[model samples]
Target: MDSNNTNVKSNADTILIVDDHPSNLQVLFALLESYGFRVLAVQNGENALKIANSILPDLILLDILMPGIDGFEVCRLLKAKSETQHIPVIFLTALSETVNKVKGFEMGGIDYVTKPIEHRELLARIQTHLTLKKMSFSLACQNEKLQQEVYARTRVERQQALVGKITEKIRDSLDETQILQTVTEELVKVLNTDSCQIELYDEKLTMATVVYEYIKEDSKEAPREHLRYHGKVRQVIEPIYQQLLKKIPLQFVSTSLDSKYTKLACPIFENGGSKGILGNLWLLKPSEAVFEELEVQLVQQVASQCAIAIRQARLYEASQQQVKELEKLNRLKDDFLKTISHELRSPMSSMQLAMQTLEKLLQSDYPHYKSPKFARVLEIFTSSARRHNRLIENLLMLCYLDVKSEVFTSELINLQIFIPEIIQSFSARIQQQQQHLLIDLPEHLPLLSSHAASLEHIVVELLTNACKYTGPGETIGLQARVTDQAIELSVTNSGVVIPEKEQHRIFDQFYRIPDNDPWQHGGTGLGLTLVKKMVEVIGASLELESYKGQTKFTIKLPNHHCTLS
Candidate 1:
């Protein structure tokens, strides 16, 4: 072997040479070393196996003829063991027989060299096998990297899917306790924790209470006692609660009286943590198992959903309370109205009866003493009694309508007859007010099928309003006509124009037009409101228009097949 061929610097490829002849080992070692290859020469198969097991060289060259164990046995042993199985082996021998070469290959020899010696040929073979081995190792490493990346991606997708499931379950409920309970159960399963719990803080942030908890079935630790601790006062774990209130998540190893465990606490907040803290979510696992980053993020996401559910449930409760309060107030109002009707109407009836009796006595028994002054006093008393009676009736009617206590019975009403009767009831008042009354009942008007009493009250109220607002000699007209869809009845009063701005509110209960009552009518201000309510009860619509010293109120009753016939 020539030592002058040392152009190649130190290289990393190592080769193990196993030969029984010392001379062959020396020559091969010097040749491989001159080419910058790390060489290890072992004389026997035992040492060869030992060195190969220790260093796992890039390639091995074994001689066929040996003392204790032949090259064939060594190659078979190398291939049998998993550690050195991939190393390429080449047989070096002086035997030129074709049978020996074939046997060498069957024993796991990759190539064979039959010679006195051929150094360049051997080096060429070594370089080729080393290149193949390096390429194989590089490919194996790349394959492992790709496998790891794929596994990581799949894990992330699975975690995201679980988060979506937990979110859906929590959001489906509006009950605060139910929402919290669901969150704890789902978190324990998803995070593989020994236990899970949710603790809510008081409004003042001075105390915390455990609202929900879940423990794994086979967990060795006993269930944690329900917590109701004052912050920084009662419990040693108060600092954890304080940290969570500050919107920070914490992971720590907690040593309890029984055993040690790991815990993670995340704050529950609304509006991306901008609002006040609602509560905290807690997860616990055995001390040997640690919480991962992805698990922490999952807890935080679920906590946000829980906050939303809690807020919605609280709002719903508040609205229910308001509705109850309003119902209570309505009941009280109805009771007061009933009491007034009973207490006041009885005396009003007696006064009217007494006045009637006095008039008859004066006309018949005291005919000689009848005088103008006495007549004026009698007239004044009658007028005030009548007005007082009307006010009581209006108030009672409003109460009935409000409570839906009045049941209206529908009947066929001939407008020709009905309108005239309503007008007749108000005829005396119209005359007393000095208002000119007009009637426009077309002979061909259709009969109305509706609640008769409601219709009667509606028409009477409208006519009374017209008579009150119309001045002396001003026209107060009651008219009825047939339209394509329904029968239209309208009440019009001249010399009074209700302001456009106040017309919309005229039908509101107790709402009076400002500066519009010049007659000091002293009305209860419920007449028009009563009309509007009665109109709706009878399936009619009312429209008001006032302009140019004239005001009109039209009531359209739906045509329910009650034609003129």
Candidate 2:
């Protein structure tokens, strides 16, 4: 044994030696042991075969010309069996004849040493064979690892493609039943399971219904169509369902009375599992072929897609219901408005005519009774009638706007003339409130091609709003200016500031600024809302700015419909 050779050391490499002579065995064993090789010695070929089968050492050294079952026979037997074939064998022989050496080599002996064995030559031969064996094992391990990696990559690719296909099939429809059915069918086909089912829990999660299921024709389990699991079944599966609710996927081998099957349960949830789970996806195979980790992950991905489809279908259903409800409410509202339009207007018109006739009779036939108090009473009666009429008109106008039934006919108009006329109508009310009115219309203002009635209604509502909120001696300003994009018409009032937060909501129907109406100029709150709608109808935009003791409502009429006059 060469001690200086780095490879010859006590590294736990085992070598078995077989020789009939005890002296030869002892000498060989000592020499190999000193070089740190684990040595096992036997005297005959039969024992050699038995020990080789038991320990399967890294290397074998055999002596030829033994008593029975010679070295050639031992090597032949070792080579015949599959388990001990790969162990390297070096034959020790005294006969140096070419014929015997060829016989040994044919029997699977790797190398033969002549009987006057050189100790160093034997050790060197053993080291070479050990190194070769280790190299062979390392190569085999590398090849196996490479094969496993390739298999895993292919499987992942296949899984991803299957997920895409399942997603497409499930999302093809917005109907809940169809979507769930498609999911069950596709999962059964893709997973090759005996059956696939989707069970949806009620909102309370106390009840579950098998809404959709697909079973192979030859499946062992009985078909369960539209089964409602409650009471006993529900209680039995409560633990499993609880795990699913926590978004933990489950795989288990479930045994029935006669057969055992594999089952997988994956939860379906909304909003990336943050929301409550909607249901569970169950897959079953007839045999005890446990679901692999990759298969579980694939099911989870499909479950996420199922969650989205379920949510979308539910949202679509909810929206359809809401639309039907809105349509019904709109019809009722239309009927009420039509009835009020007729019933209220008839009496109001009659009352107006009777009042006019009575006023004429009092003036001509009874001049003595025409006192200031009587005149004041007539004024109150007239104002009350006008307010009631205005309320009715507002309601009808809102109804028309809501249904988009208001017809708009566009015509050219000069704002320089049109705006002032609108202003003049509100002049009497402004004077009565003692509020200052400021007009800022340019001389060469552009002509607007828009719906005259819509524009008039918008201006009137804005001016009315300005009049109602402006305190006595405060200024109400109506200003018009041209910008590169449009004509800007603004109604600004001083000494009254709208809160920033409320400005955005003032245009909402029936909304009012709390405690901001000092004069109790009570209104239906539809004025600004109507204005906003009319502005949109005429293809203009409205904005509000209220700060620093001033509130301004600005309407921008686009320049595309404006011409220099």
Candidate 3:
């Protein structure tokens, strides 16, 4: 035992000896062990093959006359096995026959030795074969390393080529979806992955959207599509995302090895300032493969290209949005000017006719000046002038409201006291139109904090709309109430049912309801738009509900500003 232990510790290379003769096995084991070779001795070919497989000896010595199996057959079996095929085999025989020697060599033996072995000659042959085995191993290792390097270089070149093509695609198009789809398809081929996906994130980075996905044609799993990952998927991916968010250029194997899939994530950064993570370029494969350094580098480069494309696409979209807004603004300006021209001409023509009538009245005899018809001409002149002046005043107020100036002064207004004065101003017109005005006012109502002029304008526009839409003898209703969180003021008119579709656009400048008789309600169409702007400036919400011959406009104000007492 001690001798064997010493033999094993003395040399790193191992030798296996197979012989049926105990004497031959002992002789070979002792001879090899003495020369600092670790040796295993067996009495038959069966044990020899077993030990060879278990310990993987560097060389084997076989005696031809074995009981169960002979040296020739043993050598054939060893040569066939992948693990033992590289081991050098030498045959031991006492036969002087040249035919046996030739047969031994035919069975994969390197050399044969006679039974009366010369120890020095035997040692020299063993040494020679062991040295050859050592050289063979070193050469094999070098060849393997060279092949790997060549393969890696070729792979990198392929990846770089793919990147160039994708870069060209990105440059040629500003379509984000198309670029991402191309990236996933190309990446799946380059990485030789079963599946690939590119994940995009919202500006908040709280959600991950799978923008593009690709599954191999031969894959058994159903194909996945662009989807947002949430719930369990989010929980699993969030930690990885956070790690990459902090160290953007990170590449590490995930710790969760139990998962069936392996993933590589690369951050996509915007052009400037950590605009947060735009998204991730994710490569997925079966867990068998560890992510390689070359793959990491390729994904990083691809991610950068994708980031540039995404930014360009986003910038283009923003420019398009701005262009649309400008076009809409220009259209609004043109409409405003046209409406102003028509509104002004009507009032101007009326004033001109009144002036011509006054001129005739003045040229007539002195007695005619005191006539009732002459007096009626003066009244007509006065009414036309007042109407013209009111239109000018409304236009000026509109101009003032459009400017972002400190024109609005908020104050505590008691609707119970302030509303009646407005109603009184419109009373004569309401009576002339023969419409019934119903005021549903709550006693001891709360005082509202708001811009007085803005509020008055809003209410006046609502009442005027109610009167204009209602026929003679139709009822106009005004109601006010206080809720737990807000003050609600509503004005309702019952007569005409405004079409549901036109209700939304009623607050737009120069947008009037298309009525059969538009001439009956003469308006510049700026009244509701001006009122809407005033309400917005004063921090109130206005909602209009028109259905079944009743139209109601409600204004809601925050209760915090209202004096409940």
Best by TM-score: 1
Clashes of each: 0, 0, 0
Q: Whole-model Cα lDDT per candidate?
A: 0.81, 0.84, 0.77
Off by over 4 Å in 2: 1-55, 62-82, 91-116, 135-179, 182-186, 203-206, 216-260, 265-279, 293-327, 363-369, 404-406, 428-435, 499-505, 511-522
- What lDDT does candidate 2 reach at residue 377? 94
Better of 1 and 3 by lDDT: 1
| Models, CA RMSD each | 5.3, 6.0, 19.0
**Residue-by-residue lDDT tens digits, candidate 1, 63-106:** 88899998989999999998998999988888989898988888
Write the candidate numbers in order of decreasing TM-score: 1, 2, 3
Give the worst 10-residue stretch by lDDT in candidate 2: 227-236
Candidate 3 CA-lDDT value: 0.77
Q: Which tens-of-lDDT digit does each residue in 1-565 have in candidate 2?
A: 2123455555678899898988888899888878787788999999999989998989999888999899999999999999999999999988978999999999999988887789999988988988999999999999999999999999999999999998888786789988887888888888888778788888788877777777766466565432222221243256787788788899888776667778899988753456678888888876648788998898899889888888888899999999999999989988898788878988887877788887898899988889999999987777777777777788788878745634667899899889989999988988998999999988888888988888888888888888888898999999999999999999999899887788789989889888877577778778888898888888999988888889899999998979888
Considering lDDT, which of the candidate structures 1 and 2 is the better prediction for this target? 2
